[model samples]
Target: MQVQKFGIEALDNMLGGGLRSGRPYIISGNSGTGKTVLALRFLYEGLKMGEKCLYIATDKPPHSTITSISDSFGWDLLSLNVMDAVPTPSLYSTVYPVRDVTAKGEIREISEMSKNVEKGELTMESIILKLELEYKEKFYHRVVVDSFTTLKRFGVEEERRNPVMAKFFRFFVEKGSTVVLTVEGNIQKIRPELILSSGAIHLKREVQDMEEKRKIAVLKMRGSFFDPIEREFIIDKNGISIRKVKSK
Candidate 1:
């Protein structure tokens, strides 16, 4: 099976080269565990490989968040396609002119996109429709949803979240796009996405000796052998760098 790099070298090594390609994966962790950073790194790595990438910003405004990371890491996120489904008005646009799709689908002209910008907020269904359009146009190789938690709560009702999520995963699979969805919650508590996805990477933060420590573990990866240890990692200006494991 083919594999995709997670961008972090140690993580790539841990997963025995990289994650299996064209499968859905979740990054589960509590807040401040570097979930968004990790997801961005995944997309950044794909960008480096000249692959078309998409980022569906659901938590904060896509522009500010991407700009912050781009400036911090010296990455050109402007080149990447970003879908701004954020509830609030987005500050700026991305490479794809018709971002912030509050309307339904088929946003061809700038005037049309602007006309429907205030019609209604995008629902999960609308987002899926927009994704279908983007896939047809861009054929994105990698996709990242900053936090599925918000998307689920705001985009869909509780009764229909599961089915909607299932559809979300299926869309990526059918399109042959590797997806990384970030979710906020305890890693011990198994989430529905964890079960639906092909694999999961859990990020954990603990305070030890009056200092905070971050650890990442590959909970499960299908069709790949991985080092299932919780290795330490640090986030700096350049991005996440995992501690190298020593051979005994």
Candidate 2:
């Protein structure tokens, strides 16, 4: 496996260099855990090295998300290519009548529609295929999927969801892109074992007396040796930094 720099010196050393190149990996954590910041930092590093970076966002508008990060981290967001397909209010309105339904019912219906959007009924595969055709020889080296938990809105039957997730993974691998996938920790119905059968890195964040802190651990990495211990991490203006947890 080719090693790619993670952009954090200590964490890079911990990985014996950096993340393995051309592999699909997960960065799981609850909201406010800095998963988005970490993933963006990884992609930004690639962009700095002249590697084409692709960001696939499922939750927020891609431009808005990039703009927010660019403002905070000082990365030239315009340099990286972003592809996003998220559930839209108009799309939801088309699927179900929001005004007539109860609030809970409306939420449930919209959620289902959003999952369908992510599953590629909204043309995610077609968009990706087009990107692959255009960038195959361009040597695009980094890819990030903002969150995978959105797929659960389609329903928890693995039979329905796994195939879509698997297809997306296959596309990324075929393109030989280093990919990072994000997932919210509270929702476990989709099962990391299913989505991350290829590999994963789990990130957890906790707040102690209003100060936020993070923990990083590798749940799985197919062909590389990595430290499995959960360690502390911080997100500053520059990006994410990880520190080894000292044993008590």
Candidate 3:
């Protein structure tokens, strides 16, 4: 199967080249485990490849995240496309909402505005449509939806998230684009149905001998081989650096 570099060399090597193209992958991890940072690198690499990329910010402002990326990687993100999906403070009581800005520091054109959003219009399906429209219009090859689990409460019930999530993943694959979703929580806490139909990568951090150690593993991939060992990783001023585990 064809693949694209995951942008992290050690990770690419572990996954036997890189992520398979046009596939939906879930990156699962606990808070502060570098899930966001890895996602940033994924998009940053796509930018380097000259591929149009999109970042759907669900947990934080796109501009602030962009600034963090720029400050850390020295990569200016004023040209990347971003959708800030958080509802406005005043309008949280209603479905009406607005976005932050694009990489160029301009407001994004949302299909549904604060005044036009109807009652019970805050469904993941509806929000996805607006984003889907952008992907279709601009033909983004790489897309990331940060902490999609954040909105699992909006309109979809607990029992229905799987199918909705299944559709969400398929939507991108069907378009021949690879989409990455960051699931909030560790492997033990995730529902079995959530990973039933798509690829998954797990991240973890633990204290060892008075030092903090971070690790990553490929829990599942549809039709590819991924390194089985949990590799050690670190995040410094330069960004994430991965290394092979050594016997104690």
Model 2 residue pairs with clashes: none
Worst 10 residues of 2 by lDDT: 93-102
lDDT per residue for candidate 2 within 103-133, as digits (tens), equals 2322223324444444433443444544554
- Cα lDDT computed for each candidate against the true fold: 0.79, 0.65, 0.71
Q: Compute the lDDT for candidate 1.
A: 0.79
Which clashing pairs does model 1 show?
A: none
TM-scores of all candidate predictions against the true structure: 0.87, 0.75, 0.84
Model 2 compared with the native: what TM-score? Answer: 0.75
RMSD of each: 3.8, 8.7, 5.0
Instruction: Please write out the lDDT profile of model 3 over residues 109-201, one tens digit for every residue.
Output: 333433355543355676666655555456778888887777555567779877786777777878888878888897777765246535777
- RMSD after Cα superposition, model 3: 5.0
lDDT of 2 at 248: 94
Model 1 weakest 10-residue run by lDDT: 109-118
Descending-TM-score candidate ranking:
1, 3, 2
Which window of ten consecutive residues has the lowest lDDT sum in model 3? 90-99
